[model samples]
Target: MVDEALRAARAVQSRLRDLPSRVVIYLILAACLFPEVGYPGVWRKLTGALVGLPVAAPTASALAQAR
Candidate 1:
């Protein structure tokens, strides 16, 4: 659904960036999932989840821009 929405929104990556649109999308969803956790808490959770993956965790400023 998020992919579809991204497409509909015409969100394209024109340049190489640290945080991909998909990652930002999931971060937004995560924020909703753990409303009480706050941004920092959500970021910690995101970093933990990404530990086993090849993706790099986004910086706090980058995440804030995504929002």
Candidate 2:
């Protein structure tokens, strides 16, 4: 029982680790697919923000390095 619980916890942790990357990929795809609609300008701003130039380097670097 303990081993099974541990395995489940690890599995959950692993999936959580992957969630951010998957979300970012989905967001990028959405930006490409529905530009000028849902969040066209927003995605551009987000991309720019992530690049670590215009919006200050540290925060962008942290977000970029995440997941």
Candidate 3:
């Protein structure tokens, strides 16, 4: 899935950002799945299972700015 995401990101970032487009894409998709929860909650649920992996722990404002 991660590989797919990387491949899907054909566009490049204009500048260095804390959260990559792939992560934002998945995060938005996850938010759709769990609409009842806010971004912070969605982020927690997204990262909860992947405790072994290194992921961005972004803030609400950051998410809004990214989107």
Best by lDDT: 3
| lDDT of model 1 at position 15 | 76
lDDT for each candidate structure: 0.78, 0.47, 0.79
Candidate 2 per-residue C-alpha lDDT over 6-44 given as tens digits, one digit per residue, 9 for 90 to 100: 465563234544234444554556567766644435345
Model 1 regions more than 4 Å off: 52-55
Q: Sort the candidates on TM-score, descending order.
A: 1, 3, 2
TM-score of each: 0.72, 0.29, 0.68
Question: Which ranges in model 3 have alpha carbons more than 4 Å from their true place?
Answer: 1-10, 14-16
Candidate 2: give the clashing pairs. none
Tens digits of per-residue lDDT, candidate 3, 10-36, equal 554667777877778888899999989
The residue-by-residue lDDT of candidate 1 on 1-67, one tens digit each, is 8778878899956777777787778888899999998766787888885666776666667778877
- Which one is best on TM-score? 1
CA shift of 47, model 2, Å: 19
Clashing pairs in 1: none
Clashing pairs in 3: none
